[model samples]
Target: MSGASIRAPYDNPMDRHLATTSASPTLVTGAAGFIGFHVVRKLLQRGAAVVGVDNLNAYYDPALKEARLALLRGADGFSFHQIDLSQRDATARLFAETRPETVIHLAAQAGVRYSLTHPESYVDSNLVGFGNVLEGCRHNGTQHLVYASSSSVYGANTHMPFSVHHNVDHPVSLYAATKKANELMAHCYSHLYGLATTGLRFFTVYGPWGRPDMALFKFTRAILAGEPIDVYNNGNMRRDFTYVDDVAEGVVRTAALTASANPAWGGDAPDPATSAAPYRLYNIGNTEPVDLMTMIGVLERALGREAQKRYLPIQPGDVPATWADVDALVQDTGYRPATPLEDGIAAFVAWYRDYYRA
Candidate 1:
């Protein structure tokens, strides 16, 4: 979809069938975010008119977000707006002005641990902000809405590979709860207003420009600085660490393939991932779960330094493991993420070194 080769792994030539082509601009929220930045870059490379919006909050380092924004500023057919979706007036005004054809909504208050400390942030950003986005899409005649959900929605379900078809009523953390709420809210819009919506349940996403709070970034920083790294769950956690590039590709593909009502869907035996209305849910993950220790080892090799790890019990509101069943996504989009831990870690370490001038 861009000058940069999209390396989404699948042997289906029909992938181009879902590719989107429109005169109206594509709206990307959280344009300064890690995944959002990559998505915008890819869309810009494809010569799509894009309007980006972000409050540029201090959730993490604003400078990192600023750096991402700066890269997008150089691209043609790209525009940026500093607006908060939580604010109803501003969000409404933005939609009225731009009136985007397709929307990729990624902005939210992320992190399970942070949600414990700041629960209100989740409600405001995830719930309230998402409601605003849905309204904006509905009122503006937006064709398709691709919003971010999380693998954490699986919560207490000990299922090996989390499936969108599985029930997700028992969310462990507030962050997870809010993401689940986003899906429900999108379904409401899709049902009542005839809006097309797709919810992406992202796995543990990481790569170049990953959030500093994530394990990869923290571990790399501590190891390089000769500091001790916190290894939670006594190094017994597992995650389907999907690379950012692959995740971005999935987002783009999903956005292109607008949600459509499932003719086979019936209330007698409901499928959680799809509905009679134009609403769908798909997990975007690597599908392979790697142990925490294995990830650390990969990082050590990438940085050429062993971490001084302090093993600890699993914290509250944290899961022991998370793996995704992406059969639905592959069936729908003909794409699956295949970035190995070794290669992804190497790329991240290289980027971290260069960006920080380490």
Candidate 2:
């Protein structure tokens, strides 16, 4: 592995927070997935040995996952494993063999609409898979486990700029419910097993090589193909669309800073974001919510194609607006997501055009 720090394009103030070298490899689940792939690259660039695990399921395109994996395979200090985390025995063996000191758990069934039809996938991947990961970390002497939570957990929450301290008991979708469950499960482990766990509730993350099912990717494809793109809630939605690199930076920085007991935490007040145990939760986002139609306009400019809009009512389990309050993340990491919407969209469109040869 090269001992050089992460270079430009991916470089940020958080680079200083990364350890020069780790005694044990950092294991990142869903390494083939979009966010996991970026996080792994960032870690490997910082000279950290990374054991990347992904089942490469056909939920979307396994080809894209494989492509992401191929890039990581070429990098030094990075290794890939094909393992379905829902399988208890396989996950246990992986933990025993790798014994990673820091585990970044990013694998889970991701999608809101799909969850309505295929609720079983959410159960197997998000709930069962997450349980296996927690078990692995608890038994393997893992120092810290920084896992992905989603802004979707703010379901039915009308409060603008969602804060981690707010209660999230009313999840509108199974996917969101499962993510909330992961936080609760992590808290249980931290309270009982002395595990240091941090949960990051990421807003709508988008950039180059993002997931196919996400709005940005789908809209880009539809517009380029001259198909009418579905405009849900009649383009009335608002999202804190964070850049992928920014999210990755937050993940790595938070991983380096292990969770600790909040001395001020009390049973009387009982803060939801922190605890007496070594558990913490933060909202990692751009902090700026963009209108759906405005984002579409930006993308139109980037791709030089106008999308034919098909207006539709909001789908079940979909929130009309999402805004993330990232004050806690900034206070902890001394970094905030500052990518401009135009720049991020341009980057994604460039990658999309190049990758598709369009």
Candidate 3:
């Protein structure tokens, strides 16, 4: 802790520290997707060399993701490669070529409903693909590896404001199971290979350029198209609707720092989210739970039309509510979601109208 060198888990770390503006090349998987696109753009704005990878699969509208990529292509020192995480050979080659010192793993088979229909995609992208990424980091001397986990890991828990210290052993869906598996796998790598890993358990993130599968995006489209927007759980559910910008800020802050084992970490009275190795888990969410009906009302006001709503019971693999307790994230990285749901919804509606020319 004496020298000007940044705190690294290992003595001979491979991280490119800023001795005199020593910025390392960073890799972002799923760079064309909602959260990934925002994180990459923010990194570029901060004068970081960024390499983006996305399979550009037709799971959603590839054209929309392509447009996001198009906007990102003009930046200097920013590169994009169309590759699937499941393709071990191709992913390994890219990692070898980039020689990235830090990686953000965001490319996973997303959506609760989609996982039920196509479970293989979740296994392909979240489990196998994640293992390949770990293998690359282990050999390439990666200093810091940050990956996305989900709040859905708190399945069947009636706990308000889910904390990383709590146990998350039970998962409802294939998607949540894989996300939980990611944390376990990352812990294993950190324990064995000394990889500084941080897993971010994100809540219901929403904002501009959001995913079409999310409730905000789908409700906006349906409301504008003069169709009924489905209100799940009979509009009684609650969610910590975090803004995407806030999420990006948290991700950037977390990436700049490496996880370390707490010196006083206990084994018998263990925290499920941290380890004796250089590994940590954090919950990134708004902390403020907004009711489902309240969110729809905000959308209605933004669109200037009452949504024809069809209320239904909670679907399979859907959680009733989610609230993130971000105390540890704030302590470690000064990270917390700040956007209010009303303002965020309005901003999203504005972006949706302009982006789609509605």
Candidate 4:
């Protein structure tokens, strides 16, 4: 899709709902991370008191995470906690003390490639940490729990524009498996404890203050430094590269509109996205899928430099393509991720040059 096509203004119908709920404190895990930082800022902008939680692990770079936190620290309605959610006691204490009515669980050991080398980290953070979060929300009077799920959950499924209703039984990577597990874990809580939970499967989110391991960040760094960038799958990939701001908007909107049990959901042929319980799943992404080469071309234009690309075989935990079917998200919240890839990349490049003095 062209950049001009997606630069349209967003019209969110959930503005009134968000304004009404903005006074309450919301617990946001991984608040120092890419998506987390953006989400917290959006909440704060809407006059919401945000309790930010992050361990500040060395998954990529602690300096970057800390930098993100510094900006958030200056905000009026923002508070930070440097605690590892994987620690059961620490997590429990956090929930008890904060007593947050709403929770946005975005903390996880992110990165598909990293998960391959350190499977234990994924188990600890994604699985155990998520369990503790579920327990905390279950015990505390958390009215709504909106957590980050990933497009990786649609593993080994060759479906175009992946839908939430698809049965994702086969996850190709451990990271994908853990994400899928989170959805199931959430469903159990929603069914048994009557907790309202909504899972958002985000697709290739990129922008300013993004993760270093992500394509946009790495590519920008390598290109500016005159280094070679490893282009996996021989650049034969298409990603639904949703902008961070768009994703943050969707998350806040979704959180305001709490999940509810689908009355039409029956046992005979159940829908995976919605349940008989107060659980729901939605794909939060740009509906447009851009080619990897096309994305590189855009990045080159933004950076004013050409990347030295080294083509390579598809990685073990990698997918050739990913496209999100965001119809459900629009239908529910009246919000769509319409940020153009060109604009998003340009914004990221500008931030990169400013931050790195490149």
Candidate 5:
């Protein structure tokens, strides 16, 4: 492999050498987001320079995004750019200017139900934005690209403990479809450009600074305000709710260990999780699935209040259960999300109360 061309801030050979010798600075897209924010925090704490980019879209709350950015700004070795990934020209310029060595592409239009009504948003952000990220990595000297995928890709598959090797051709919603499309797009880049890419199929991620639309946050807010919380699937729905920090740790570890072609890969009996190219996929989750009612109970315990529950039928584009099989993640990265639900809830509740003054 040829040496990457160094841009400004690293134009000097000595400076470039020093920067490259240690862990290379990572460009984290969606840096103001939930998982992205945590990933950036972890990367900065590890003494790695982080170039974070976020559009700060008002999909949920821009204020929350700014709050996450504020904390990151205070940290050392952290820089931020408020750029929209969906803009091809701007994204291209960002890559040319930064010439990042590694990229964590976590920006996306993220909600399964929301996708039903807002398909165009998914098309713009997940499809077009992801295309820009891939182009940036390919044109620049990005060594590894770690992007977020979702367990929703296992749509209509009733299998327990969803595995990465299983086929994900069926996606129930545009959100899931876009995530699956990301994996395909990354593979194309890897096969064509030798871009080492890893797609993480995250389960129901919950904790501090999570998206307001997510169950945990909604439940917490409603319960605290003495409002009735919507219990979907008659509270029978289950989720493998992985903690934010654990997900961040796994992402860091995976990023450090760049994807590589599987020597054992054979086209005759191809493994969906790995390829002859430097492309791979893994399921990042807590492995333990908890029912919706159980999660509410945990939240109630954490908040010291009982939730007025309004049980409802399962909604469209929603799955009844989601469980992840993380053996492959464990075998490869030597890591698995192990945060106890109770502990995770407690931490999130603490942060929410403090952040919202509730």
Candidate 6:
């Protein structure tokens, strides 16, 4: 690590950052995934010296992920590390080499539906791997740590918009349970080590170079191939579909601002979301839950082809709807997602077509 503050790029807002030593680099754990690639791109645009680590696993299409990595590999202040965080020594060695002051840990086994078939994967990546990250941060003297949680953690809740303050104990899937476990584990780290930690709960994130496993990407493929797309719960589902760039923006802003201890927090009647230690959790979402049918309509319009729909009941480990309550996020960070659903979907479809020549 170098010992000077690298000037942020010209496009950054005046108050977006503070002067800091350059010896501590910024590290992103899942730099090749949809949200991770976007997050890495944003950090690079701001002239932040960054390190991106990923195994480039064949979770979806390794070729697509390789394309994302290709984009980052050419940047001036960016570097890539091919490693899995579940391998304790390998993960620890990378952290030691980077000496990062701020870390964005987004590498994890994703997808609620897939968790049913691959529960062990979640245990390895989301649990043990996260433990490795916490241990690394603890020994490295990291100033602040930002990581991804998910709205899937809002399982078994009928609440209109999920709030950070809400108790998220009733997880309906192994995936949600693992995310909830992350918040809990992070809370413990904050309490024991006084580490500044923030957990961001993202809604349905979609965009170009997006995961082929997500609904939007899958539907696009199905519709383009002249096949019937699965319309779960007979098209009754709703999602707060957030754009990938918007999510990346929120995450960057959060990681730069060090979390602070809540002055009013108490133990007798504890709030699971915040702590007297320098720890906080927030929802970064579109704040607009669009119906599945409406989203399909937008995709159809973008593709210029009506979807052949096969309506079916909701799959196990899947929820009917998801909305995010980001009031606290706005009050703290002064930024919220403003992109409309139509614009995001259209952009994704355009990028998908160009990337795959569909």
Give all TM-scores, in the order shown. 0.95, 0.96, 0.94, 0.95, 0.94, 0.96
Estimate, for each residue in 85-180, the C-alpha lDDT of model 6 and write its tens digit.
999999889988888889999999999988999999999999999999999999988888999999999999997888998989999999999999
The ten-residue window of minimal lDDT in model 3 covers 11-20
What is every candidate's alpha-carbon RMSD to the true fold? 2.8, 2.0, 5.8, 4.7, 6.0, 3.0
Clashing pairs in 4: none
Displacement of the residue 348 alpha carbon in candidate 3, Å: 0.7
TM-score of 2: 0.96
Write one digit per residue (lDDT tens) for candidate 4, span 259-309.
999999998999999999999999998999999999999999988889999
**Clashing residue pairs found in predicted model 6:** none
Compose the digit string of candidate 5's lDDT tens values, residues 33-140: 999999887766555688999999999989999988887775667788999999999999999999888888999999998999999999999999999999999998
Q: Model 6 segments beyond 4 Å from truth?
A: 1-21
Report lDDT (Cα) of residue 62, candidate 1: 99
Comparison by TM-score, 4 against 6, better one: 6
Best by TM-score: 2
**lDDT by residue for model 3 over 316-358, one digit each (tens)?**
9999899999999999876668898889999999999999999
Best by lDDT: 2
Clashes of 2: 0
Off by more than 4 A, model 1: 1-20
Candidate 5 ranges beyond 4 A from true positions: 1-24
> Which has the higher lDDT value, candidate number 3 or candidate number 6?
6
Model 5 lDDT, residue 339, Cα:
98
What residue pairs clash in candidate 3, if any at all? Answer: none
Candidate 1: give the clashing pairs. Answer: none
User: Which regions of candidate 2 deviate over 4 angstroms?
Assistant: 1-21
Pairs clashing within candidate 5? none
